[model samples]
Target: MDVVKPKNQRSKRALEKRAPKLIENPKTAMFVRGGHISQIVTDVMTDLCKLKRPNAVLYRKKNATRPFEDPTTIEFFSQKSDASLFMYGSHNKKRPHNIVFGRMFDHHLLDMIELGVEQYKPMSSFTSIKSSVGIKPCLIFSGDSFETEPNYAKLKNLLIDFFHGSDVERVDLSSLETVITFTVSDGKIFMRVYHIALKKSGTRTPRVELEEMGPSLDLVLRRTHIASSELFKLATRRPKALKPKKEKNISKDPFGSKLARIHMTRQDMKQLKTRRVKGLKRKRDTAQEEGEGTESSPKRQN
Candidate 1:
C-alpha cells in the first residue's frame, strides 16, 4: 500500500528540517569598540543592565578602528563568553554612532540588525537642566497597510522582543505598563510609545485613550542577515515515539455476524417496500441503516 500526503505537509516537513535551532539559554554579550564612544551606546547598556539579565558581559576595546571588521573576532569573544546574543558599537566619519544587534545559532552569526543614530545627546549635557523623564506605559501598532504587509508582522515581533528585553513574562497586559507601538505605512516602521489614559463623560464609563510619550526613535533598520526561523520550530519539535501505536481489531457490530443478502431477500414484500420507502425518504437515516445492516424482523429473535 502507498501512503499519500498533502502539499502543505510535505513543504512543512522540508522547512522544519532546514530550520536553525535557537539557543536555549540566551546569554547576551556586548563589545564597545573604537576611540570615540557615543552616549546612545552607554544608554542602551544602562537599559540592558536595568533589565537584570542573569548573564550579560560588556567588553571595551580602546583606540581601535572598525572593531567589527573581522568575523573571527566576534566568534572568538562569543565562544569565550558563551553568549548567544551580541551587540557591537563603533563610530566613524561615514556613519557616526553605529550599533549592530545580532544573534548566534550554533556559535555562528545568524542574523544582524544595524541602526545608526543621526543625532546625539549625552546624559551629562542634560544634567544642568532640572527636568525628569519617566518611562511610557503603553504601546500601539497601527496602519491600514499593515493588514496585508508581511514585514509589518516581523517589525511588530522585533519591537516586542526589543522592548520586553531578553526575559519575557506572560502576564496581564495591564501589568506591562511600558507599552511599545508600531505603525507601518509607505514601507516604513514607525514606533511610538504612549501612556494609557482615561477620560470621563457624563454618567458614562471613562473613554480609554493613549497619550504619546517622549524620547521617540525613528530607526532605519538595515537587515544584514536573516534570522533563522528553524530555532523556534526545533525547540518546539516533539520527540519521536519509541514504537508505532498497535492496531486493534474494531468489531463493526457488537452482536454477531451480519445476515447474508439471500436471507434478507426472504423478508415479506410489505416490509421490503417499507424499508425502500424509509431509505429513499431520509438520506442520513438510510445511510446509518445500510451501514449497520440492522435486522428487518419486527421482533429480534434471540
Candidate 2:
C-alpha cells in the first residue's frame, strides 16, 4: 500500500506557484545639429509625451568653453525631463554650434510591466513629434547685402512639405522689419525659433539664436495637414490624356501597297477593254472578207 502525501506539503506546493515575470526597460539617445536643434526638440516632445502643450527650461551658459570665454556666453540648454531637450554651443569669439538633442525614458517602470518605452510614453513628450498647428510655420532670413528670398522660399517649402500631414490647413509667409513670425492657430505649444547672424561677409547663412513660441499641439497639427480635396482637384485639373495609337495593318505593306494595287487595277481594266475592242474589230473584218470572197466566186462561175 502507498503512503498518502501530507496536507502541509500540498499547501506548500500550491503557495510556490511561479511569480509573475518582469521586463527590463530600454535606453536610447539622439544628437541633433545646432541648426536643427529647435526643430528636433519640438518633434521629440510632441512625439513622446502626447501632451497638448509642453514646456522646457532654457539656460544660457557662461565660461563653459575654453580660454578667452565671455561671461554668460558659451552655450544654452532647453531641458524637460518628460520631454527631450536641445543643447546649442554659443560663443562670442567662435562659431556657435548645435551640440545634441535627446530623450531619456523611464525604463525601469516600463520594463517591470514588460512594455516598450513607446507603449508607456505619450507622443507629446517628444519635441519634434508634437501635433502641428493648423497653420504651417514659415522660415525667413533678413539681409540687405544678399537676396536670399528665393533660397529661403525653397527651404521653407521643403521644410513645410517634410513636416506637413494630412490634417494641415494652410501655410502663410510674411516678413516685417528684423523679426519673422510663423503665426499658428491655437498657439500654446513650445516652439523655439533660432536666429544666427554670420560673421563672414557675403555669406547667406546667419549666426544662431533660439526662442520658444506657438499655439497648442492640436492646432499645430491641423495647420500641417494638406487637404485631400485640394490635392484631388489639382490632380484632376491637368490630366495628361494619352493619344490613341493607330493599329497598323501589318497584313499589308507599311509603305502603302494600296496605292500600287489601285494602279494595277486601272491597268487591268484598260487591258480588258482593249482586248474586247480588238476582238470585235477582228470579227467584223473576217465577216467582210468572207462576203467579198463569196460574191467574187459566184461572179466567176456565171
Per-model C-alpha lDDT, please?
0.53, 0.29
TM-score for each model: 0.49, 0.18
Task: Report the lDDT tens digits of candidate 1 across residue range 201-231.
Answer: 6656756665544334455554455555886
Kindly list the per-residue Cα lDDT of model 2 for residues 1-302, writing each as its tens digit. Answer: 99555479765664343221132111112122222223333343333222111232333222243211211221221121222222222212232212222222221110000000111222333243222332223344333211343323333343333222223334332211112233322322122332222244456654333323222222121111122455435522532344345545433577656422222333554346444454567777889988998988844453
Q: How far does residue 101 in candidate 2 sit from its true spot (Å)?
A: 14
Worst 10 residues of 2 by lDDT: 107-116
| Model 1 ranges with Cα > 4 A deviation | 1-23, 26-36, 48-56, 60-68, 119-170, 184-189, 194-215, 227-302
Candidate 1 TM-score to native: 0.49
Instruction: Give the winner by lDDT.
Output: 1
